[model samples]
Target: MMQMPELLHSQKNSLFTAMNRFIGAVNNMDQTVMVPSLLRDVPLQKRDPDHGSYLRDAEADMYTYYTHLKSIRNEIEWGVLREDQRRKERAANTAVNAANLEAEGEDGNDLEQLLQYHLKGLHGVLAKLTSQANNLTNRYKQEIGIAGWGQ
Candidate 1:
């Protein structure tokens, strides 16, 4: 049996609308959500026109954002590749298993022998499907041009 999640409500407000809205806003991941806090907190300092180190915190923030964004993008890309590799492996295994089952029968006149022949046909279909899937995965990997991540 499954139970519904309880709605959170303030004593003054009967509905959970405010809490739900806040949760949704938090997950939106819009950089605008952080802008007001950043503007209020980070002080801007003027520097000489010729100096190299101008507004250190702002520069730091830019670098921080850059590194973190790059890290996350690479992580997701590698994750996708790994998932696709697993999928291809599973499909190939299915084809092999089907082929093995089809090869196990020797009595051609038996009812099970007919089923085996049908299964053998299904095995060929599965093998083609797996081959096409692997080909597509390889093509996508090439198009994306991501060789590897963190290695």
Candidate 2:
């Protein structure tokens, strides 16, 4: 029995791997790989409207939206990694300062302020990414006749 954290980690890794493959397929503009890859993971409902077997008409648009979303997500992931590194650096610096006792008067508030600013920016970027991804996914669902299971 996997622990909750282990399961979550596994899920996250799987999602990232799938997204990476999807990104590669989009970058190569290989519809043969991209279409089947996406459709294989997304199960079709019997009640879904017949928008053609492979949802052929919507594939191009969906790919465009998905690629744009992938770019946004990349940016967000970069921001998060940057913030995490900054946080670790800040903690290490604070620990060093505590050990020194001499730099206490110099004020580490500036570092804290900068970290807060970066975190806020990262938060904004992530929020925008989420919104964009959600919008694109919903649009794709609608176009492919998977929005609500039925026409």
Candidate 3:
């Protein structure tokens, strides 16, 4: 007989595998697989000796899993945005400092140009990240059956 710990581990592995498959389907834009995978089995209220309870546990577990995944995904996305913005801001500041140094005859035009170029690249990257974040946010909202997130 399998121990409780082993059973739990197996169940967790199964859930993780399913989650990865579901995410892959979503990424691939396979709606047929994605929809059914998202709609996991419903959990049973109690274990019955005669009747099976696979669907019961599956339903409850899937709901809980989805909720937790959503939170984690949101945190990761916001963290990326925050880091990107911080990097861009730092680059902009560095460029400004370089310009000031050039004005004070402390640095050459080449250094200043390099800083300016970096600042421009940072800005461009930040814009693209922001757009990607917006798309992800919209997709999550739609998937979870929430109305628009007010942009």
What TM-score does each of the candidates earn?
0.26, 0.38, 0.31
Tell me which residue pairs clash in candidate 3.
41-59, 42-55, 42-56, 42-59, 43-56, 43-57, 44-56, 44-57
lDDT string, candidate 2, 27-124, tens digits = 33332222424533342222225553333333344455565656655653455457778899899988897877565554578768877787666555
Would you list the clashing residue pairs of candidate 2?
none
Q: Per-residue alpha-carbon lDDT of model 1 for 1-151, expressed as tens digits?
A: 6544453223223223333333233233232223323333333333445885544445433324333433443443355357778899889999997787589754447657777777666555444433433332332333346333212
Q: Put down candidate 3 lDDT per residue, 1-151, tens digits, no spaces.
A: 6579978877654534444443443343322224534534433233455876422343454434444444544553455457778899899999998788778776567778987787666555444434433443344456667645444
Off by over 4 Å in 3: 1-107, 149-151
TM-score of 1: 0.26
Overall lDDT per candidate, in order of appearance? 0.43, 0.52, 0.50
Stretches > 4 Å off in candidate 1: 1-110, 147-151
Error at 106, model 2, angstroms: 7.8
lDDT of 3 at 15: 35
Candidate of highest lDDT: 2
Distance from true location, Cα of 52 in model 1, Å? 58
